[model samples]
Target: MKNVLTYACMILMLTSSFMVNAQLPSKEKQYLLDFNKSTHGEQWQNKWNLQEDPSTWYGVEIKDGHVTALKLYRNNLKGSIPDGISILSELKTLNLAFNTIDGELPEDIFLLATLTSLKLEMNKLKGSLPQDYSKMTNLEELSMFNNLLQGEIPNGIGDISNLKTLNLSSNYLEGSLPKSIEKLHKLERLELFGNKLAGAIEVDLGRLVNLKELILSYNQFQGDLPSSMATLSNLEFVQLQGNDFRSLNSLLRLQSSKLAVFDSDDEFLNMKFGANEANRTRLVDTKYEDTKRN
Candidate 1:
């Protein structure tokens, strides 16, 4: 009887040890630990306390025992994002915008297939965008505006069929707009102003039937405006300043029936589209003025 009791106690101790070990090694926990240490998370506006349940952490949302979202916008998070972030297989949204986070964006973060919204805008992040953006098929909104990112826009970015709003403005990105961009059937707003991008705008832009605001001002774009743009029935604002555009007659004709906004610097209008009443009338109402020009 004494031997049996001792053996039973030993079995219980071994089972408890197994349980503890299994619970101690969580990928999500490790991700947080690495992220916190790597980014100086202790200094964040809403610092995370690793001692407590991750669900209770600030800006972190856990669903079904998995981290689903991490929104630390403008949180003063410094240092590069850790590659361990990709371990959050259930993560849907990751917004680290308006922070001091600087360094090349980790390519693995783009591999998060569950991500629907990834906003890292207004950070000091440098380095070229990844060439292979095809892994993020579930992405809906991708905004990386006002960063120090350089290099040509990746061709694979257009593979994100569900993408709606793509804003990469105010970067050092160069190269022509990829032809694959026409594949984004769901895209609405595309802002690429203040870059070094050169090359004629793709004629396939007319394929973006759902496009509402097309902001492509302040680039090195040259060549005649695509006539297909006249087909964009939903286009409300077309900001095309600071570029060497050859003509905008087709775009002006678009303004005749629909309420549209066009840049009205008389000299610029005359130089690009020629002096026409349609251009003047489109400018007179100025209510639809492209506010993003400034």
Candidate 2:
């Protein structure tokens, strides 16, 4: 009787595992397999056993028979992303940062309407951002810093109304700040440092009342620092060095008591302030340095 019971338990477990594997649609499974092959999965730091069930795949999140998230940060993933990635229709988050992934970003990646957070920072992705990015309405965080991307930031970026963090620093992106960017009312952190962007910041940044960290150093931006920025009471860290701005005098009226690190080209602007104001904010007016990335 003991032997029979043990055999029955093993059979039940096998059946349950089979059922779980069967839940994933065959098309989606093929998409995963293609992704593995295209990215040299066998060489990854944490690779998946293709012979096993899709649920057991590394960095893949399966929910209700659909791939929901794929996070493989710093996992030694090489080669470019497969175009079939858009087939994972229910994917909500896709993070493949700090890897050796190269080539132009697959256009299908922007078609994932369900994606809420898309992080591909510190990769070798090259090419300009797509012109029509309005489909990613659910995106909350879009970070693609430290890449070789160039061309102007698309005007369609303003359509992602829910975006909170937008970091595209250390890239070769050029052109002036888009006028449509002022539509991000919920934005908190905006970092575009170490780019080739130029022209006066004409966008109405005062609309972003929730902004906290604003870094735009090491660019070709000139003209007066917009006075509207002073209304951002939530700002904590502000860096605007390495630019040819006429003056940063408007920032002296900043109302944020939480201001800690305020980096700028002090010598270039010949900026001077009273001791009372300097002591209150502990403002650091020094040259901004670019962060070393791997």
Candidate 3:
């Protein structure tokens, strides 16, 4: 009778396992299956098995039975991202940087309201940024550098008050910096270098008291540096090379005693600060000195 009881216990355990496996949510299962089919699962450096649970897939993070992050950086993921991924309502971080992923960003991508950090840098993505920034209220870090995106930065971007780092460099974006940018009081680093953005530099930048490093080199920006910028007390580095600026001498008079690296293309501008007081700031035009990609 003891042996019979042991056999029954084993059968019960096997049945429970089957039940657990079968209980996998249909939405999550379909998302993985669709992603695999769309992204050419066979070619991925880290391939996914369609038959297994998505939580077990590489670069996919699951929390509380929901996908929370999809970090597939430098995985050699080619082709466009499947639009089905917008269904991941619980996703917080979506990092697909340093890949060969090409094509326009899916419009539905803006539907991800829970997204906090979206890093798609060093890809072949095209098309202008979405117009409705209000949808991404939780976004903090948006790094989309080295893409083929064009058109003026949408004014709606200022609506994302929580943004801390905004790096849209090395794209084809044009037009003046939006005046609404002053709304980002919490912004720390703003890098808009290597683009075709023209017109005078936005004077509102001085309102960003929390700004640390502001890099706007290799663009078509014109006009004098805003006097308000000298008020920033926490600034450390400011690069404004390869542009049409009237003067940067005002920046040398910043209230921030922590200013260190201030690079530009003008030899005379460099001399203006370098010729004075101990040479504390390293003023030079290193925008094209070292051989490198964007």
**Model 3: residue 130 alpha-carbon error in angstroms:** 0.6
User: Which ranges of candidate 1 are over 4 A from the true structure?
Assistant: 1-25, 255-260, 264-294
lDDT, candidate 3, 61-110, per-residue tens? 77656678888777778888877677888789988888888888888787
Global lDDT scores for all candidate models: 0.79, 0.84, 0.79
Which 10 consecutive residues of model 3 have the lowest summed lDDT? 285-294
Q: How well is each residue in 1-294 modelled by candidate 1, as lDDT tens digits?
A: 999999999999977755543453388888888988888988988898888867668888776567788888778899999886788888899988878899999879888999999988888999998877777889989988889999999888988989998989889999999988999989998888789999887848788988887878788988888888778888765677788878776665553234355562336544443444565443322322223211
Per-residue lDDT of 208-271 in model 2, one digit per residue for the tens? 9999988898999999989999899998777787899998878777777776666687743223
lDDT of 1 at 275: 43
Give all TM-scores, in the order shown.
Answer: 0.81, 0.86, 0.83
Which wins on lDDT, candidate 1 or candidate 2?
2
Report RMSD (Å) for each prediction in the order shown: 9.1, 5.2, 5.9
Worst 10 residues of 2 by lDDT: 285-294
Clashing pairs in 3: none
Clashes of 1: 0
Q: Model 3, which residues run further than 4 Å from truth?
A: 1-24, 266-294
